[model samples]
Target: MNNEQIMNLIQEISEVQAAGNYVSFTCNNFGIEVFVMRGEIKKSKEWDRTFFFRKMFSEKRTEEMYQECLEYLNKMKETV
Candidate 1:
């Protein structure tokens, strides 16, 4: 999907996240349900600041799907 469409999806996910719940949606191209949950990453010794977390899930997880999810996350970060 294009950047605008991707951004829209990210926004929708963020809205659901803000409400303290997980959101699931099917990817039109992959026909797989993508689940998203929001939380915070614990601070580590190497990184003092705790980073925001966007946990993603799929029934048949693969590298390509992971990359796609990362793409969405990067886009979301950019918008933020």
Candidate 2:
């Protein structure tokens, strides 16, 4: 969506401008981003907050966990 359209879509949710490649928001308690390419939504992902820090935490931040979390979160979105 365009910026105005994007803002309307997120009216019920909180959207913040972060210095990065995607737009951020909250979904299923996981930080989510609206993936875009060439100024258009490509695919959105429900991020496990520490998405890029898995190597440092030694926690269960496996790919499987990420996929599972995304599956659950996407399902939540489909319902909306």
Candidate 3:
């Protein structure tokens, strides 16, 4: 996606989160699942709004969570 499209997607995700909703998408090719949720960090007792991306096929996954998250959203947009 182009920069504008990417920014729009990011804005949409942020808006959804701000409205107390969870955002999730999946990438079939990589069997990756991405989730963005609002919560708190127990250790710091701070708000910890974040994204959790995981490879569905394996218990052990790589450190490419960011890439997987983007690819999942792109795939979702294509489907929509």
> What is the per-residue lDDT of model 2 for residues 1-80, given as tens digits with 9 covering 90 to 100?
22453354354222222212233443332333432211223446443232221333334554444455344434434443
Give lDDT tens digits, candidate 3, residues 42-73.
34453323344334523333335455555544
RMSD of each: 12.2, 14.4, 10.6
Each candidate structure's TM-score, on Cα atoms with residue i matched to residue i, is 0.32, 0.27, 0.32
Kindly report which residue stretches of model 1 are placed more than 4 angstroms away from their true locations once superposed: 23-33, 36-80
True-structure RMSD for candidate 1: 12.2
lDDT of each: 0.47, 0.35, 0.47
Name the weakest run of 10 consecutive residues (lDDT summed) in model 1: 45-54
Candidate 2 Cα misplacement greater than 4 A, ranges: 1-53, 57-61
Q: What TM value does model 1 have?
A: 0.32
The runs of at least 3 residues in candidate 3 whose Cα sits more than 4 Å from the true structure, single-residue gaps closed, are 24-80
Sorting all predicted structures by lDDT, with the top scorer first, yields 1, 3, 2
